[model samples]
Target: MPGEDMAGGAADTGPEEWADARLRGGADAQAAQDPPETVRHTGPPAPGMVINARYELVAPVGHGGMGEVWKAYDTKLRRFVALKGLLDRNAMTGASQAEAMARARREAQAIAKIEHPNVVTVHDQVETDSQVWIVMKLLDARSLAEVLRSEETLTVPRAARIGLQILQGLRAVHAADVVHRDVKPHNVVVGEDGQAILVDFGIATFDGALAVTQAGAVIGTPEYLAPELFDSSAHGPRTATPASDLWALGVTLYEMTEGRTPFPGPNAWEVQVTIDTSPVPPFQYAGPLAPVIEGLLTRDPRQRLNAPEAEAMLQRLLDPRAAIAPTPSAPPPEPDPVPVRRRAPRGRRAGALALGAVLLAGAGWFALPLPGDDPDEKDGKRAGSGGSGTRERWKDTHPLLKIGVKDDQPGLSKFDPKTRTYAGYDIDLAYEIAERMGYARDEVDFTTVATDYRSTALKVKLVDLVIASYSITEERKTAPPTGYSVDFAGPYFEASRGFLVREKSSRYDIEDTSDLQTLQVEVCTARDSTYEKWLPEAGFKLVESPPNTYQDCLDKLLDRSSDIYAVATDDVILAGYVKENPGKVRQLENVGGAEGYGVGMRPKSPLLKSEVCASLKDIMSGQVWEDLYRKNLSPLTDRKNPPGLPDLTECEVQSAGP
Candidate 1:
């Protein structure tokens, strides 16, 4: 039914009509008084025909398989509106008449509940003269089907703009618990002002409504159906979800840009088979928008890009700076390789050790200074060496750059004992910044730091930089007596605060912090960390004694005897724990506000902090940041929609001084 010529109007085949009839009632029913052949060939309604004493039909505009649309004047509202009624009920059996009426009522109900600018507005629904009619707002617009038939294709920017508006409308529909199963070019109308409005929700599914069609009956246009709706064995059942609508939207976008759907065939069955077995064809004209299309076209619904992620990508395409740049014919030469050097071990423990060792060794290490500490030293060799000093002096005095990091977090930062090397997102980022600052790879030292000691380690000059998933906060930036007085550079990574619970706790349906409070679940978080302050603010019940590190909280969660039901921290940190434990734990993301992880430094190193901030900005703007994320966190997190690069406006302000 979907692959038919839809340039003029929708034309349902015999099977689709029969499926609709079965949805209303059985096929054994009386026929209309008029003969079927006579009703099928009846002339259009006259231009001056009046309907329901409130509408005057001006002219017939279009005809569909089940109904016909008319440009009519609403006398009661003193405006013009689109009127739709059964094309010819007398031409079919009694069951077909009932099916057409039911479809009209369902369409009216679905569109009336959604009041977005991009969605069509419904005025009223009435039954008169043995015909069901729906009244809706009229526009000087044409269906996208007609436009596509004439123009063949559209520019990428224009298509993206239209796709974005449709996505917004779909989001509102989903928020109301409705799914538009029929989202194709035929259902979209583009006005003279270039505003795209989604119309025709005739086959939409409401949350609590009964099934409109019987089991195993194909509902949507075959060319636009999602992969899951084709074969129940390969990908789940044929049940429709919001993601199904997104998949249809992806097909529509592909058609708009390429002048044809990705899976093309001579017939509907062939198209369905191709969609089930073939990958999306490579793009020829879709340059920057290719990724968005690929994200939507992912066969797995779980990994496909959601509405918000798709909308963000479309918005980025609208930005002028996001235009594609021309590539050079020759490849750029690679940089000279930096020599490797064995790292000298500091007194602090490495993060690759056992959790018990971390809990015991990291408890009171921050209270005492390192063995070679000298309070009066200002030559940049010991603790507080560069206090209130110049960048040139600090760089000249320190031959090797020392960076404080966490070793236990699997994806963010982890230490491998077998290879005796540090690897993960933060590790790669540390190397990126160091290279940008004129330091060789072997000239850098990574020392494991506990969560609560990040700022103190920077203030005491235990390390030149702290990249241990350290969050930027006002309390940490303020001078001593009130706060830690630590300086922060770029917020290189953006993550949300969330909860990590054992898989068994999923039965509680704990979606957010409020759910945890209502369930009286005891939560555990690292002491002196940001979650320590946020947990009480969120009204969560904390354990009698909090853990000293994230791993300690995770340990408590793994122990059956412990009272901890969930571990609270940034989602990035929780992702690591989930990856390590596998099916044992899962993260509940976005339970709290977003937290930006920054590079922490001593407050006195202003010039050096500025340099690091600039380096971070460069890394985010290039492909290096995305490559690092894919290598480390993408497997554990949402690979289709990774976190966006954070805005570094604060870095500019900090660099300009107070």
Candidate 2:
């Protein structure tokens, strides 16, 4: 009872959320178990305090981070309702207040858009001069928190029924790619008729937005937070995925049947570590409801039961004739053991399969030290580190990535127009990125993209990832919507600027860097190429003719329309022209470059960069990258050893400053 108020942490609703840590667990938890702070008579509101002229506040039922919730009467419709709106709007400064306002409206609109019985109905959201009020269907109810405090532990059948309804609501939320990051008993309201409705999306988040919580902190209750939350920091930005929510669901169900939370701690960090390390205790009273609970509670997001799978598992439990058996199929061989010490016992949940524990024991997870808590570091690794949940998130939405590869170019990504096939190191690298991102080869759909259209295709999202020997320049990377506004996976291959010109052309008269100023070399360059910036800076006042591709430059050179076929592209690409055209065109000699080839993606996608860089680094560390280079670029290399892998450090996204 001493730490009960502290244990029930408030759900944070952006900058507009009520500014108090004690107001945790959005609704009843903040009022019932914790201090009321300065809120007066949180019992019933005065009759005359109407909100937005449409709903009259009858009583203050509950309140939390997203301000006060009232039991109200809709004056227009003459029906009972719940009124939820932000707090201290005028107190907040400009941008912070605006973002919170947008977040509130977004949550209201998203939940209202979905039609599901288990989810509460959002009727309308009205913005006033000072505040915003969201009107929702009001149910005459005592919360699950009230039931838990009174009943202690629920019967197995009752808990399952409650969990089933909650899962249905979760399915609907996840279908919209939204995550209710703080799902606890406090957020659930059990109506008088025994219907449990999920409510309060104050901390609910969509995949499109970059970060869920603030930089260094996680928003949910300490006990219900998943182990994966510990892995994320400002260093490794983490968004809330449904898998994290499912972990909360498991904890909620556990609390319903067990009376006390599975992991009890005086502080939030200890609770997180306990979740990551300690064994999930056996379900004593949750008879047939054990498998899904254990499955959903796993630290590894990949192994955790997803929304659809968890829904199906819960559905089978509801049907009396189809009681689930843990191992309906034959037992398989034991998995190979993991490096981390698996000291926790394998408590029984489902039948003999012990699938969750057996796999968890061999899971081989890592945990890092949090500054002052750095322990005796051993074997160059730390215990209780968190896992990245990005792969599981991608599987739900964009498992099949549309990759942009050059259709006609050789050596990098080449697509045969007539044969309709793609081959080259860039194509191989794209498939490798998909593989490390938890996708199979067939899951990738390759599209033909010329060099000029690469940036455009990625900007409009016609392609999810592009690996067509793209350059990594500061200008392209900094360009807002059209350029490197997205993340880059590599400098997987490095190249310097070079020109492909005819042997008989006057371009050979250029001896050194200083000669570029005097040479009136009429250079044909590609549109959107970095040379547009690079050429003038390097003192080349050459008359520029922009084309769609370097191939077009070669065409102009061969047709005698241009004095010099010029480009500032990878040496491998210039070599391709020389290899294909015999003596017709040759690369400019002694011209070295400071550029690297990169895999490009949308601006705000962190996972694309994280997983892509992970895969690129992994392949380069082993024989895989060398083999890829030998297979595709070896022809261009003329059987010589192709360039060693680009420096791994070049591909990494620099950690934000502390």
Candidate 3:
């Protein structure tokens, strides 16, 4: 009947292709048939028919995946509300009907628990004549899907505003520990007042609650599912999180701007595979909101922008001043053209006397002048006529960019010996900077640097740059007993201190700093890292022998007999380790002191420092930085706090420098 023509004839095709098709219609779509039903009702209710006694169905207004809606009058309340019940319940037989009815009731229950303007409100639910009925606040609105159909695309600002509201609703839903498993444009309604409201909780579920759908069944629209839901081999069975809803929201936003979804294929399987394995297609019209869309669509649910993070990004887009970096009005320009020049020898170090003078000057130290510091230096050459004053740009002098990085950090940085390749956030970032600095991918080399040796690597010219998770501190900028006296550029990333504990260990429940103090947990962190100073000051006990790297701490945590109750480090770092050893390790929700990661270089190379800092600033303002972050870090953690562009004021070229 659902696929019938108005003339009471069987149509050639089912309503499955209709834009408003309520039932799942993808390739794998399936619904269990209901058991034979007992006589429940004589016929469908007409206008003014009071089947529930207290309410009368005035007219059918719409239908959803599992139910039909009607404009109804509440006789007792003396007001009108929207009422819902299983779609053609009497006509449906067997398990399919039962599941639909159950889902309808579940929707009622889920909406009733959340009270937010952006979320639909449930007023009453009742059972009459063996059918479940839900009463809800009537809203004068149209589904976003319908709006998009008429208006092929919306401006970036409008899409961001709508996305912000949806994200707000999601926040409230997640606060109640619920996951709106089916988040799509059809599930979002835009009201006459221009306020967007999230609706239809038919497939929503409480966190940790047994799923209402059949096991291993792929639910929701195929195009909107996060990678984890469909990619069985890579991510395993579906484990929906609030992050999943964000992914759907990302797709919805993409559609609002691009006039279509990111992944398009002839069949559902192909689309699913694309979503699981491929990067989001490049945006042609996303404009300033591209980063927000990219952040939301990250395949790694953990690395994906959470509700709060997404909301902040949207809010910033609406108010540009608050944005991490003012988004470019157009796509960023191509990489700075590389200059054709003779290559300098590898491990070429600047004069030691120049670096020593800057470092030995103590806390207020500054770069020293070189022969090329004359004011007349211009057109890529020195001011004076003599060859002695011929200035060399840092890129020309260092044709090969030698970067020191952590080989053990899982998501932040790691080396795969089998493939003889380095991969992770640090690795990707180094490559990005190198490209901007006019170096080819092959011209860049990565050297593994231990936590204690990051500065030494730079000081001794073992590496031209240290892109390891090197935190910037005043002590590190000063010379001698108190510090490494290393100069830094562009705090490219901001990391927060948090703890990682064995998932199955029952010795302690560390949720926050208060728990750490109460449980007297002995935490292990990488030696000479920020955590070493923060933990001891926060009253956390450190293991007698601290590990040389976060990986070592994770190893100690995995050993059942070790006294190390937890491993503490930047949440970004811990997230990777947790992902690398899933189920065996988990990060505590507690986030402590924050630190900004910077690129470490020798104190004398002010020219190179300025170049790297400028390159980082440019990258942060574009989509590539967001892409790199999503690729390397998003798959590791779901913590709501997302790092923004670091303040580049520290990157100002010192007047004392050549």
Best by TM-score: 3
Evaluate all candidate structures by whole-model CA lDDT and list the values in order.
0.68, 0.62, 0.67
RMSD of 3: 19.3
Per-prediction TM-score to the true structure, in the order listed: 0.48, 0.44, 0.50
- The local lDDT score (0 to 100) that residue 98 gets in candidate 3 is 63
Stretches of candidate 3 off by over 4 Å are 1-47, 86-107, 276-278, 323-658
Question: Which of 1 and 2 is ahead in TM-score?
Answer: 1
- How would you order the candidates by TM-score, starting with the best? 3, 1, 2
What residue runs in model 1 are displaced by over 4 Å at the alpha carbon? 1-49, 86-107, 129-132, 320-658
Better of 1 and 3 by TM-score: 3
Question: What would the per-residue lDDT of candidate 2 be over residues 181-251, giving only the tens digit for each residue?
Answer: 87888788776456777777766787554344666676778888777776664213355677788888999
| CA lDDT, candidate 2, residue 648 | 64
Over 4 Å off in model 2, which ranges? 1-47, 87-91, 207-212, 233-236, 320-658
User: Which RMSD values do the candidates have, in order?
Assistant: 22.1, 18.9, 19.3
lDDT of 3 at 279: 82
* Clash number for each model: 0, 13, 11
